[model samples]
Target: MVWGRKKKRGGRKEPVFGGVAASLAELRLNPLDRITVADDKPASRAAPRKAAGPGGDGSRERKPSQNRKGRKGRARKRTRGRLSRLFYWGAVLALWGGIAIVGVVVYVGAHLPPIQSLEIPKRPPTIKIVGADGSVLATRGEMAGSNVSLKDLPPYLPKAFIAIEDRRFYSHYGVDPIGILRAAVTNVLHMGVSQGGSTLTQQLAKNLFLTQERTLERKLQEVELALWLERKHTKAQILELYLNRVYFGSGAYGVEAAAQKYFGKPAKDVTLAEAAMLAGLVKSPSRLAPNRNPEGAEARAKVVLAAMADAHFITEQQARAATTRPSYAVKPVGAGTINYVADWVGEVLDDLVGQVDQNIVVETTIDPKLQSVAEAALIDELAAKSVKFNVSQGALVAMTPDGAIRAMVGGRNYGDSQFNRAVMAKRQPGSAFKPFVYLTAIEAGLTPETIRQDAPLDIKGWRPENYGHEYFGAVTLTQALAMSLNTVAVRLGLEVGPVNVVRTAHRLGITSKLEPNASIALGTSEVSPLELVGAYAPFANGGYAANPHIVDRIRTVDGNKLLYARAQAAPGRVIDPRSVAMMNTMMEQTLISGTARKAGIPGWTAAGKTGTSQDFRDAWFVGYTAKLVTGVWLGNDDNSPTRKATGGGLPVEVWTRFMRTAHEGMQPEPIPGTQRGGPLPDIAQLGRQVIAPAPAAPASVGGPPQPVRANVRPEAASGLDGWLVDRLFGGR
Candidate 1:
């Protein structure tokens, strides 16, 4: 029946579908509609009798078929997530490891040690110069050098310095490790490389034993040296060494020299403000020099003051006051009394003592007042004669007759140069040496009244002439000396023997070599002005010759005696006391009535000699009062002759001016034995017994029968014999 219904359904399906379609005109229907058919094989499922209730509910109760696949997917997803996490962490770690390695390399390179150079001594403090009042005058140290022990420094000064330059100086063992670390960190943070973390000891090490190279090697060397220094010295000692070795500008090395240079005062006397200024100069001296840049110096000083305030070394009020204080005005260095005299003394020391370092302070015999007056007078005189002569160089020396050099001038402008003309330059003395010749003749029993022919005399091949070619015939010895007659002098030198004159000059302190010829009397021998003054000093010092000396004694800064002047007994008489006295009297006459008359100082018994060399190349006026001997030399440094310069010109003026001022506070004392019988008569005739035949009567015969020839003349007179005859008999 179902098969028939099925067959009929197949036919009827179209009709049902048409009906459904017609009914479904309001509702559309799908084309494959199924009608339920009785199952023919329904009974075949009863074999297992397994009931499927709710279809897949049983499958849900159990593991589903796709559950294993789902579990596998979940496990794979978890595994994948875990693998991704591992990869991400690996990349991060790689990047971090690279960054750490870079940092380590950079740090090691930055802190590496550097190389070393230079060998500096770690010496004790040096002795220095001090004034009479115990004020520092100069120093002896390294360059701009000197030294001072830690114990020598004032406690407060070191404290102040430490507080400002290095606050942790006492705590550190030569170097501050913490400070170094902090500096490193800060430098790295800011990428700035300017800051330094060196301790005081490190700085000293750099200054003393290491180069100032800005490298890690140098820094490491500095650290080693600093540690060694700390082990060797106490902190106080280190600080003192630092203070002394540190540069304080203006060529000053130590605190004492700096104090003298900047404040014109001693280190002990330095004011708070002055000290701050000097301390400030250490950072950059040239840029902060008060002389070159006052504003910058003042600013730096303020910074130092601020530091002092911060350190509690001074109060803020004090710092402000110091900052506002006017800049200290320093006098130019080397501007002291006796600039010329000091230079001359230095030269003399070169011979008497030895070569000295520039740091040496040579105490001289220069009288400040006397030197001032001499310089002023010379300048005024030269200015007055500026039209006639352009005299720029002048020198003067004054000394006690016993060879105590009292005053000196090497040149008019001491600041311009330091060639000491007084002790170094050898200039012709002109007529000044004539007195030595006269003295020689006097010592040989000749007096001031001795007679000599002043005619045209031919001495060997040398013809002597007067200054103006005018001869004063038959003049007395006093007249010849007073008039400075060249012919008379030549004749007298020949009479006394040139060797004797030279020897006599030596006795009077003339150390220069003298020409053993007729020119000796004419000043052909070159002599230093100081030597001339020393030579003439014996005449004023009662015939006693003394070696000229500038230094009286030498001592260390701590008052330790280094050397003392050898005690010398009064010099043995070089000339007869009577002869010296007579020479002194003659010189007095020369000063009063001779070429040096212009040098006459009223109310003072003075003696001097004027000299003008050939062509006026060297002019000299050497003189002496009862207490002082002075010599003035005027000429060009090149030895060129000045236009109108002469011994009686500017030289006399200089001598007179200095003497006038030198004797201002002193009373005039009479020369010893000057008033006693004046000078003795000439005995030249007693010794001179002419043997030649009375000059053949000169054709004018009958000259009082001509005194009988005392001695006979030799027959074969020739060469030396003829020359001797000619010289002794005043041959033309």
Candidate 2:
């Protein structure tokens, strides 16, 4: 507070503040320092203070030792220019990057389907074809067993998928940057693309809503959809959707289907090994399918097991045990011939229930027992005789007398060829077609006792010959049919008019087109084995026409809704009762003493006709009991000639094998019109052959309508036919 200067004469004594300013100016210090102190002076510029200022007090305002000019020489004035450094630009760049990210998100979001309207597509319907026994024979449709709930599946099954496909499946926000980085680094380390970054949720998005395109647009959409899914659905729900929608190999579309297809079990019953195997299939379904490549599937399964162990989903021992003995896919029981049935059912599903828009069950009429027998019969017989007889293919169709199909084997090996020979192939029936001609003749007032000469004769340019070109001069009508005498058949066809024979065939069941010519009796018309077998059904049912039918009733899978059912309306009578009886008698002789003796059903009454096509191109024997009518054909796909293989030979043998087992445990029903115990009353009226002392002469019989008589026993009379077959044809 002490004054530094005396007052001037004209001015009041200097104010204290003014003196302080003057003192500062005199000291060459800043005038502003009077109120605001300046920065501390540099130690090098401070002058040493006089010792305690003569009073030993140390507190003193030190003076500058260096001049202000000297201080100015050591420092520079501030300059103005750009203020930004690297850190400043870094902050600005970060803001722009955030905007770019937002813009990209919006662009991807724009392409997404409306979240409000987004919905899972409807699962395609599966058609399950069931056998007559109501057992599942095969499944036909887009998915084998598509819809399976996660709760229904074994815990290990889904865990196996989670371990191998998405390790952080529970934690990620759909798009896993950590996973992406890890995959990138792994790929870089391997110097190739080795790891995949897609989560299970991403895969499900691709399958459900996107085409399998690798374009950036699709990928971005997939990412956006995955994120949306994560937000909208619980982790478990998303996982379940993925499991139910993901593809498996071999036309299987989901874990349920894959489980049934490969392991022959439901997803819920899947073992640890099976779960691992199925999970491995998600990576490359086609390549890792067990059926296609068991080794690759097993190796991939081991990888899945290891992953499961690493994820702590399964114990190390369990994983090790699964890898030790790798799981194998089961060969489905409903393979081979069963698949043929499945295909046949598939072809008829539309007609039965209209378009197959929903899951349905087709209850077929196939007898599983007979089906196995028929397949085995055809395959075993062909395996033994196909090369020798030059017959490369064979088919069999068996049905109840009411026309419910019992068994159908379309080919020797269904895997080799899918062409359904039983229902699709049309081949000449040869003498197997004589029933129509005989039936027509019987309808025209001729009896089974009517005599017809077996002597060969030419009709126009066609001269039908018997198997050995030999003739039995005076054989009865029954004898002619039993012997399969082509000349007699032709003579009868001309006598009744081939057009009439064709009409008779059509009335019975044959749907194939027939040419009305003399050779029609010789079976020049091409007919599928199905048509031939169906036409023979009238005789087995005693006069009713039962068109061959495989589908008995069709309905929805739940069995609550009925789609179709065969009508209870009566089957129309195809053949006259008297004529039917007459035809049965004549055909029965064919089994007893005809070319088809080898095809006779042991301990049961059965009748069928055997035919050998010209050049032995086709051999057929269509036989029937009161219970069943079966037709078998042996030939080549190219219609190549067989090596003298006649209907009386391999065809007869095959028929015998199948019928023997088919008729097991069945009662021996007498052939209709034949003696059950006592001779049929009015044997003449019933059309039973009136075997008397000798063959009746035309004068005694008054042409042909009057019943004729013969002395020969049926057993003795049948010997001639069997002898001729064995001698002329290579018959068993």
Candidate 3:
């Protein structure tokens, strides 16, 4: 069909198509050329019959020796036009690198914080005290034992934390990309970051909404909140909200408080070698805490039991019998000073249910085996006699004669002083405050066998010496309060009126203020061993007034909701079942034969009062036992002075080794009203000394006994009818 005719011949003009006159090599050849009719010699001299070749039989004719293979076939078409412009700019830089990675995941998810109001953050409340027989003694806050479920644990403990934290955790969608290219080729062959592509749903989306700060916009808001917690939870509810919420060191926090703090059990009784040492404390939970690096938590629980036998979820003989028997966790029974009853239940937990937000359950009358025998009787008697009684510290409380505390240690190492020294150390309860100056002289009539003059004494000039300033002359106010005499407790605290011995020590529960000054009848007033064991629990519960409490109720850790309970106050009679049987027969003769016969409690007819203050500094004993009154104090948080240590020595040998382990199996009771004993047969006759009618110059419409000036001796201004006419007509 080629008929090109614009023929100029030699002037180089012979090509014409439909008007045919072609000759410039027949219009540069092949349009599938078979136009053999080119005999137009005169018109355009037909000489182009040899262009069609490949066997169309016009056979290879025109050849100026094939012009070097036509310049090497145009140099292979300019190398295929530079490989099609390098695949069109490599597909426009891979579509702008996938739109700059979706504009860096929408500018790190628009700086996060609003995935439909991302919830999951609550968790810090936890109170849980429990111990009046319901066990779990202490746990205050920051989660130590609750929220458990991934189907209540033990499917090899969340498959041993997804075989060392997410073996493609149920085939990842919460950002795994082949586990971040196998943890970036295993941290570039262990050059550093020792491997952690963060996929337990991106560590529960950076512990429930980011702050561990590594950055890159917190790893792109932890992969967009781990793909919005994998589209709002389910791979077993995000592996049970990432095994309850990860962190497992001592301050615990989930997986049932690190399986009840590393296997004191729960999480369905954890075993497989304590679930590979609590899934090897999810890597660095306080540096692999099996109670602080038990050999780096048994070498990270043998690398989580070889990643739970390489994720077959255990069995290379159960990961070599789970690292050949690895179960570590044992520290909970009164975990040292029961955190001093968890720091007095977090300082009375905002005054008994005022602000403690959520989780509660307090219930406390603490007898966790008498709080581990009052913290091993005050840390084994201050570690065997605290530098031989220079006594660094000590405290004990035990209660229940109506006060109900039942064991508190408070020091001698509540981890070297949480300073509760039995409810914050007021000290100087020396001469353990002569039982409220013999219970205000047996309610002002006087009877622990009357007789007083332990000879030498002084009032305004201060010579109250007795610990060997030697005097027992006519002693019988129960041997002058069993030889703690101090001038017969400054003459019965000046005949029952140092403001009636500070109102019988604040109606028998000494709420710490008591300084009615006859040197507070020798206790020199500084109270607190919980108000001297609730003012000696009314001489062991018979005339009641012990209000020393320690959370006896506070409810809601699912016991529905009570908030508080201890209000059953039947403790009315502050002292008078005959002055609580004559002050428990004069402090049971100072624990039978005075100065607390080393705080005796063999079969429990206990009665205490040792004390020792001023210059021998503070030391106390304060016993009780018509079912526990216990007090115990000791010395030195800089109130110094202890080497002569006495409250009859080491607080009566730590109240006779904590009332002989709190009267083991309890059944000896009698010191309450001692069956009409020691008080009225002229004060129970034992070495009879009834001289006490010495008082009376006390009455004045407001002005009298304030005139004592003798420095260290005699101030006997006899007025009660001249001391009952010299003790019933001179028998003295």
lDDT tens digits by residue: candidate 2, 1-732: 867887678875544655764565455533333454445576365544433222443234435554556566545321111234556788899999999989988888788878778887877788888888888887788665757777788889999999999999988989888999999999999999899899888998899899988988899899988988888899989999988888888778888888888887888888899999999999999888888788888899999999999999999999988888766766632337877788898898788778878888888998888999999898899999889989999999999888899999989887678999999999999988999999999989988878776554545545556665555555678777877777677778877887899999999888989999868988899999998999998898879988788898888877889999988789999887788778877778777666776667777777888888878899999888888888889999999899988888887888889988999998888655554333222212212222223332332111222232334233333233445346533421
Residue pairs with backbone atoms closer than 3 Å in model 2 (clashes): 692-710
| True-structure RMSD, every candidate | 18.7, 16.3, 23.2
Mind giving the per-residue lDDT tens digits that candidate 1 earns over 612-675? 8898787788888789888888878887767857777778887888788788778887665476
- TM-score each candidate: 0.62, 0.73, 0.34
* lDDT measured at residue 450 in model 3 versus the true structure, 0 to 100: 64
The TM-score measured for candidate 1 stands at 0.62
Candidate 1 segments exceeding 4 Å error: 1-203, 206-227, 230-240, 249-252, 264-276, 283-325, 337-368, 379-388, 457-464, 555-562, 565-568, 665-667, 678-732
User: Considering lDDT, which of the candidate structures 1 and 3 is the better prediction for this target?
Assistant: 3
- Winner by TM-score between candidate 2 and candidate 1: 2
In terms of lDDT, the best-performing candidate is 2
Top model by TM-score, which number? 2
